[model samples]
Target: MNADELYPKRVRSQKSDARRNLSFASRRRNPNLRMCQLLHLQHLDASESKINGSSICNIRSVTSLNLCGCTNITDMRLIGICTLPQLTRLSISWCVNIKGHIIGCGMSNLTYLELRGCDGLRDVNLNDISALLHLEHLDLGNCNNITGASICNISTLTSLNLTGSGCITDKGLSGGLSTLRQLQKKKQVTGSCLHSMPSLRRLNVSRCWRVHDENLRQMSTLTKLRYLDLSGCAVTGSTLGSISTLTHLDLSRCWDVTDVGISALSTLPELQHLTLCNCQKILGATLCRLPALRVLNVSGCSQITDVMLRAICALPQLEHVDLSDCATIMT
Candidate 1:
């Protein structure tokens, strides 16, 4: 007789007992039961799981955890997660309930943290996360409460996304980013207390209305940048010469950028992705110099006719092109 049919109740109890008795070694030998426990788990994606605090407390040995969209999660649950020693990456994006001084709870080992769309987060001090020496990637996009002071102490950060974080003004950028850049460059100087994070590669400050030419000029010190998104910022052509290392540039909706600003981008030989959507000033024919361009978006550029298309087609690597809302492009 089958084990289930022979002794249904007793068999189920025995199986549970057997599972409980199974050691880490035995679990490793049985690959099928890998998900039975957290001992060997290195990554956990509980996004949108509606999981509770007790469930999260049971998880250990996981290096990466994605709790994105876990709307039910609160700061009380995060206290339990802080006990996880090996957690290196944590994504709590859109978890609105997680607000106010949550990172100070033993999250020093985290290298990547995403708090995007966490609108409830306000007036958080960056000094709280300053102890995280290995932190490289931090996304605070749409977290309007986060100011420039929130990033001053994180000198190890390489990628930072502050899209739509209106609270960050020129003072904050200068205090944090400009100071960090200076600290990184002056490593040989004596009595330099600041740690070097010269590895900064990507920065997105899009929709920061307070960002003007002065702010962009200050950002030019970040020479290692590969991807930069300054869309909707108040910058002019003069800001382009400083960031010649950029490969992916997004200037969409920047009404201030005219042919002069577009002409300045020709110096960026590494540029691959270019977005100029809603830029009403571009009259066309200046993009042919960029040979590495693969993606181009000129949507809402009313003056762009077949002349711009001809310049874009010359790019041998061009793979994606968006000309939507262009009145001159024939159907």
Candidate 2:
């Protein structure tokens, strides 16, 4: 928000991330910051700048803070952040320096936290995050040393993103893919799974290649999932039909996904937007069962011919279809 707009009690987020980082040069408070103390600022975006806790501790009413790309800030300043009782959303994406517990005590009101590129996310802090009883959304893409085990207890989460978390495996999310394996790999078990957070609506495990169909099946109690992105994972959509609430699904580049697995998706009556880009194995015959589908992306399906296109044509509700690079389709 601009200087003139900061006086309101119920402040909205700034229109852009371009806001100047409220810098307190050499711990000397900026005279320009005098205006910030007087206003009841609700949202602050000081990303990629020199803003520190010493300068920001006074902004008590701030409910949302975007510190994404702020390379200078460290976990030490989180004590200053914890002072803001109303702070809920904090984005520290790409802040590589924070190598310790980012969350301090007394910041329980937080509902959304994004640490997309921080490497300091260890089991020590990931376990602490479960204390946030009100937390609903968390993004830990490209982080390290964290598993579903560390976060399995946080039953309050509604949206979670583990994209590119290669350390995560089938045994982490599921007790074990098979009963035989369950005993062999029982030590890796996190007790509950996709079931641990039953309230989850949107989950992104894209590129978590260790995740598999057996990991997603039988043990996956994700009945509330509406948006699930398993793109580039090892999943074959074996038990995906059980997630009947799904509407938007992305299985792009999932080379193992086949027409047999795609057949199970036919049972998802609510599915509308489905993406299977580069998944060449499917011939597109089973997609006819998804009559409610509105958007379909089968780009790079080298095996798809005119016959497959004709099968997709039967989807009367299709609004946006992507069949690019299907060289086999003849006029």
What's the lDDT for all of these models? 0.66, 0.68
For residues 8-37, write the lDDT of model 1, one tens digit per residue. Answer: 221113654443233333445565764436
Q: lDDT tens string, model 2, 155-264? A: 56655666555465444554321111101111222223544445556666666545677667643465666887777777788678888888999999999888899999
Each prediction's number of clashing residue pairs: 0, 0
lDDT of 1: 0.66
- Give me the overall lDDT of model 2: 0.68
Off by over 4 Å in 2: 1-38, 153-155, 166-192
How far in Å is the alpha carbon of 101 misplaced in model 1? 4.1
RMSD of each: 10.7, 7.2
The TM-scores, one per candidate, come to 0.70, 0.75
List where candidate 1 sits over 4 angstroms from the true fold.
1-38, 69-72, 99-102, 117-125, 176-199, 236-238, 289-295, 307-321
